[model samples]
Target chain A: MDKRILVIEDEEIIAEYYKKILQNAGYEVAIFYNGNDALQYYRQFHCPVVVTDLEMPQMSGEEVIGNIKEIDDDQVIVVVTSYYDPATIINIMKKNVYDYIVKPIEPVEFGATIKRAFESAEYRKMKKALEQERILKLERQIEWFNWHESIIQRNYDRVDRELFSNLHESFNQGAGFGSLLTLIRLIASMAKKSNGNYVIDEQMFELIKKNADVAEKILNIFSELVIIMNRTFEFEKVSVMELHSLLRMIIAEIEKYAGIKKMKIALSEQKPPYKSAYVNIESDYIKKAFHEIFMNALKFSKPSTAVMVFVDMKTEGVEILIINTPEIIREGVVGIPVEYENLLFEPFFRIAKVVYEEFETSDYGLGLTLVEKIVRKHGGSISIANILDSSDISRASETKVCVRVWLPLASEASRGERKGA
Target chain B: MDFKKAAESMQLPLDDYLSLVQKFLERLPQYREGIFSAKNSGDMKRLAAEAHKLKGVALNLRFEELAECAKKIEIIAKGEAQIADDVFGMLEHLIMEIKQLMLAKENRDG
Candidate 1:
């Protein structure tokens, strides 16, 4: 919305004339008597339209145009000169001058030309903005597609492994189909012996029912697992929430869990501007991702040490860092190595034994993996790295683990909508 | 000087045109001095440059006769033609005439 017009004319009377006319036309005007001064001013404040006289003292209009074009090729320049030679006109045209005004210009026509120049400037600004937006959208789409492909591949691998292991264990342990067959045989034999008299004991009946339930439960769980693995997720249920509010809610919930280990959960205080930074996310899923990461941090943290959470607004998005000091490094219980830090997101990858007895289940090692998957689904990424103490010059031991998560900010359109609401 | 015609060509009100004429008259002495000094020194390039500057301002103010005289001086100097004494004389005459007219308007207005 810059409506300033720069006039570079050596003739004081003519420069004044242009100022009066342009000002009357509702434009803010800055007049320079020489090209050098004008160029200095232009460098500071880029006016939308530049009206420069060709014959000036220090620098000629052609030189001014060349310098301005070098600075910004999209600059709009209009030449004003008394000499109307065809060669000079062609030269100016080759330099990409927008239009030329001869001496003793018609006020109305000059006004019209300047109006067109301003229109061209506006169009160029809009086009540049749209091009940047298009590139960002394409980049996001490419990232989403890449993440989607990896998730699908990982799902297949997990399902295949789980199916083979479950089927093998069922056949070996006789806890599923084998137990059901044994119970069926015992019931048949009891019924045959009864022979119109009730001879089956209540304990025997209860045992048969319990085995049948176990077999059914196993089959049902397998089917459910397959369905979950192949399910297509819909991501339309997103809301724009401030980063501070989301972190506060998660931290409040995890604070209780940290209390049992006599550990403290500390959240870094964010400034007002950064605290209000909004991110578009499914609140429930993002909470789960953060919860898993926080749990991991608390689990590996030395007892009674503080788990520090820092939320920072990065250029591309919001970054949350959870830093926790590990317990004393013992043999086979050291911090994750720097080179293998990325493996933290791989399924079934465990660096050490589970410290918390509550999470001792089949899904024990998949916490960070599931966290990474959920983060990636929301167009985010999670990474873990070991933090070496600055004082430790040898760099032999890592003191802490830092779990970093980056999530994209809410889109401008969504922010506008939120503002309206 | 045809004040109405000049004002109309410049697309300005008579009062605004008169004030612009005053500014031009103020700078006329400097332009005249630059031209004669360059001619005396036989610096054709400087003479042509000074004349060109005067011609551009004269044309903008619709001083057709003055502009024509300045343009002739610029061409003759740039072409390395013989320094005709009458060309300088004619330019002086035009500048004096415009200066007198602008001064008269100022007196009448005051």
Candidate 2:
């Protein structure tokens, strides 16, 4: 196969050298010095293998690498660095870098490394393409299921929307959007996950023309989720004193990406009765949730008004208050909550009236399930109700969602505290 | 284990470990940085730790005489023990031995 490759090395000499070697080996090569410019063509000119040096002047190899690989994990990146150390190893492994070449380069070794990188990249592209093809094939089977179910529903005069929805929704998620809709979604996601490249052999190229590149669209959803997933986490044991400091760290990381709307996070327990109950939570999840909400608040709210985090020891346990300065109405929450959507924790479910354009990605966990299970493990309750605080919810479609997390606290400690009080 | 065999396994030059004083003289800045930085950083007191590592490497590489000198620096840096004159002398002596080894290799290779 005549493979296409992209090289983003700053040195003209090195770039020329690589281009010659790759071209000689029958690969069509493209080179760029700038990171952002290279990134612009990332999807447009999807290459299987990418070679970059550690310190590029403008974006740094690390930044360009973070951007590109997040778009597709399978993109083979061989890092060329002068310094080989344990610290370097830890940082490099985080992005799942394919391999590294330590400098004072050997010409033979360099050539060999690039060959290996191409093989790795090709392997990933082939794997994702095959998985996508399998998913699409499953969808076709589910489409047959959808057809049968739809015909059955047409014959029955009375059918509830939820029940009717369930008939297809169950298999849609299981097989992904019932052949037609979500199979396309998964294919597009898989394409994005594969760095927007596809196996464009004569057969696939023909099929893609009819398919409308649903792979790109489907991949967009997952890409957005990935962007959310990659947000920062200073995963430290945060005491109540460190809440402001934690927020500062969170703000520092995200400030480059999103503007803060008025978020004032304060530890509300002013007295000595403060409890340090630390749960091993992924800070990435917490940051993602807050960033989405803060972005929404910034986009929707009146500027200069303060959005706040008010924490209190509620009956359930520690209640975290994300005080939204309301301008936009929440969407999709009405009547009874749907089971699957509840698990996604997405804004669409929280507010029924929310426009699709306005929705942002949310967190997931078997943790939510397990917490309730463990609460049941130790006999605890879980519930939610919105307090009518002075700063309005009048314009909102649903009440402000203050998620009250009821962790099972130590009863002996509680009783002792109560006696002391 | 034979000190020479241990030195060989560790990939350290024998003569370098033998003349400890000269080696210390040559690596004074590095030794100072690694040792004192470890003291201040509250991380692993790694300079002395690294010296110990070098000692083992030197011993395994059959540079036993120099390894003995490295042990002095290692003990002083790592062990929270005093650096006696004899140990310091061994370090200088090992450094000189290492120079001689390098000089010999150069003469043959050249």
Best by DockQ: 1
Worst 10 residues of 2 chain A by lDDT: A358-367
Point out where model 2 deviates above 4 Å.
A142-421, B1-110
Q: What is the lDDT of residue A409 in candidate 1?
A: 75
- Model 2: lDDT of residue A160: 40
What is the number of backbone collisions in each predicted candidate, taken in the order shown?
Answer: 0, 48
Q: Evaluate residue B99 in candidate 1 and report its C-alpha lDDT on the 0 to 100 scale.
A: 78
Top lDDT: which candidate number?
1
The residue-level lDDT of candidate 1 at A325 comes to: 77
Residues A261-323 of candidate 2: C-alpha lDDT, one tens digit per residue: 433332232323334543223344444444554444344444454344444454434444444
lDDT of 1 at B18: 77
A-chain TM-score in candidate 2? 0.34
Clashing pairs in 1: none
Question: Candidate 1: which docking quality band?
Answer: acceptable
Give the per-residue lDDT digits (tens) of candidate 1, residues A1-421: 4688999998888899899889878999999999989999988888878999898878989999999999878888888877778888888989988888877577888989898787666545433443454465477887856875676566667645654554444443434466667767777776644557756778877876876665666555455444434554444423233556677788898787788678877675556666455665656667877887777777777888777777667676887877777865457545665434665676545655333644322233556766777777667888786655332222353456777789877665665343210
